[model samples]
Target: MSTHRILIAGFGGQGVQFAGRLLAHVGMYVGKEVSYLSSYGPEMRGGTSNCSVQISDKFIASPLVLEPTELVVMNGPSLEKFEKTVVPGGRIYIDSSIVAKPAVRSDIEPHPIPATALAEEMGLGRLANVIFCGYLIKKLDLCPLSALPAILKEVVSAKRPELLEGNLQALALGFSM
Candidate 1:
């Protein structure tokens, strides 16, 4: 991929910012120029949250993703708000468990993954965002699955060492899907 302008949107507790940060870290880990910008509503847990991530081989001019090449929406409201912001032929990854309605845009390709459901089933409901991140990495061929352990180690080792194994399992689950 030359340049990927990714937009991830969802409710605050859905880990939208974490997902975007994970993607940006992956981009950085793979030696790409990366930028991440996050926005959230006033409320902490249930408010609107979204992030813009840019990964490019060249210099990135802006962090704002007005028209994203890849869109990930975790809830129905997010889908409704940002569905029209994806560029034509761009790919959208929807959390099918939360977003019951299908995307209305015909120009963009939509991938409906039951991320939240699968995470819940696996007893890792809060890691749905990581699951989606894994699927995104697999689907986009952004990086090798073998590289994730190291990445996850770096991400969770400092403060959340107990979460490493669960996160790994969640990533594997999503990748296999």
Candidate 2:
């Protein structure tokens, strides 16, 4: 009986909602009860955005994640806004490339990854969110790595077929981290 309440936060164009959706899809594929809720500011592109995703073996009572077991922050403001919302002993994944600050709390575990830098180095700068997703997938053991390609195909092939290869590579790179 495992339950993960995950909150992903970043700028509107940083794919925060997409990452939440991906995690929700993964939970469904693995036969877990899931809930996803997305929120954003008035401005579409550069404004604040976030999404909460809950994955559990049992039923999910709500979509709001007040105390996340897992938190992923892609920018400094987001880190500041949501850092304290993580439960004690929970995990926080930070994009060190964009966020210069460190986690203030000592009780939670902080994983600082240069996801944006790594993705840029791989020539896949737009896929940083997916990179973070890959890292979360590996660290959380939410699903088998082998199952990711099929899932990626199912998610991205219809809308953006050309990005599948780069997304796959980004996931692999993040998993290796």
lDDT value, residue 19 of candidate 1? 85
lDDT per residue (tens digit) for residues 1-177 in model 2: 578999999887888988898888888888889999987445345588889999998888989998999999998988988999999999999999999998999999999999999888889968899999899888888888888888888778597888889988888887778
What TM-score fits each model?
0.94, 0.94
TM-score computed on alpha carbons, candidate 1: 0.94
Winner by lDDT: 2
lDDT of 2 at 84: 91
Worst 10 residues of 1 by lDDT: 39-48
